[model samples]
Target: MAFEPLKGLRVLDLTSVVVGPVCTARLALYGAEIIKLESPEGDLMRGLGGQSPTGRHSGTYLHLNRAKRNICCNLKLPDARKIIARLLETCDIVVANMRPQALARLGLDHETVTRAYPGTIYCLITGYGLDGPYSGFPTYDSVIQAAAGIPGLVAARDGEPRYVPMVMCDHVVGEIAASSIMAALVERSNTGKGTFIEVPMFETMANFVMQEHLAQHSFVPPVGPAGDQRLLSADNRPVRTKDGWIAFTVNTDKQVQAFLDATGKGDLKADPRFATVRARADNVRAWFAL
Candidate 1:
């Protein structure tokens, strides 16, 4: 038997592209019935993600939108409100990634939805928060990553800023949104009320970066620089073998000693610079170089 806890729940997916679709997709995976509402022109990722045999559904689109029903409606038309209303009447949740202004223009904003259907779990995934200066500004995954200091981390290591070669912000924020929706589901079951979840990509990803890179600078009296030296080390990468590449890590003294012996560098075990964890951390550059 399948673990379908959300089997009976209907999710009205008023989202397009990666972030919102990613959240609803996880809900669908957990057995929620997802009805993806698409514009007549369809999702931008349908064509933008990659090549498609039919020239409509790209691999990225298919992967993200899997196991969900779709509805084609032109929200610009007056009659479309009727369609949305009907859908909302039966939906247990509404997940949207559209900007606040755009959602308001379409009459699908959080306030409108919650006002009409107080029991609807409304999840809005935005690029920025509702009150900030950047709120409602146009943004995407790459922009969010850059805003979150991801490229800066790379620049610290390689002297050049670069994206992670994937829509990492979208994926991270989407999974977070899914977990948040699940938490809301739990809360609603107890309180008999829905939740308005706002997952801002910029804030969320920035917090993620800060959690790791804030380092010694997290305190008022800074002990050291902001970035983690070990993480920013240029040598912190997969090592090349004769046949292929191999990635491994040795943190504990025992593991480090074993690594030294295995790599025919047993002499380094007696070296003060790489002897202890503290020494390795203090000499991160030299430790990584070894």
Candidate 2:
């Protein structure tokens, strides 16, 4: 208990996939006593990756759930409900990512948890924000990526906006959720009260990404859409070697100059229209082409 920042903390974790599981896993890593509540079928990630430390657990599941105790409970059963309620009574936090309706059915909703354990920090992870036309609609990572206009971003340069190579939005939202819960825990320490926090993945990702789209609001004169010209270059990809891909982004002027020098195009440094940040941002395609 003395070793962990949250050593004495007790977490009732009922989450799956990349976002919620990673949040609880981070808590457990820091010495929180995290009890992972799971269905009979177990976490869907158990079968996501073929390889594992042991043959039984998949790579995805192992990475998502480390240093946490697993408890199999089918919330559909009355006995399971009693068990969950008991756990809630002693827990400091309960992190769940189920749909609002499903959580209500299992009596794991905010009202139920607060009624049973008023001091428990109840964190809800949903795809969309609590109030919206799309709230309560079941969504996954790929679906959100498609809806978030990322596909359009990808399609901007010859190809259509494509799915990001990884489960980045999910992981990003999970980190945001974990950070929020930790903040709430700190607040609780001072106030002797826990708070209900919602970390909607879609909202979180959208918020995280909207900065790239803030062209009109950020500048005095509105730029056309939020399209970043430097990022628009078709060469904005990993350079491939004989064996594998070496990924890097050329964002800063110094970095671009370095690349130009390395590629024997040092004359670009003297070019007036390519020297300034805004100029580079505006004419990145032609600059790179030259």
Model 1 agreement with the true structure over 1-290: per-residue lDDT tens digits: 88888999999998999999999999999999999999999999888767787788899999999999999999999899899899999999999998899999999999999999999899999888898789898789999988998999899899999998999999999999999999999999999999799999998998888956789898989887888999999999999999999999999999999999999999999999999999998898999998
Model 2 shows how many backbone clashes? Answer: 5
Q: Which candidate leads in TM-score?
A: 1
Cα lDDT of model 2 by residue, 105-218, tens digit: 877899878876778899999988779888788888898887776777778765876888888778887788888999998899899888999988777877776765564446
Q: What is the TM-score of each candidate against the true structure?
A: 0.96, 0.88
| Cα-lDDT of candidate 1 | 0.92
C-alpha lDDT of candidate 2 relative to the true structure: 0.82
Error of 1 at 188 (Å): 0.5
lDDT of 2 at 243: 100
Model 1 TM-score is: 0.96
Ten residues in a row with the worst lDDT in model 1?
A: 48-57
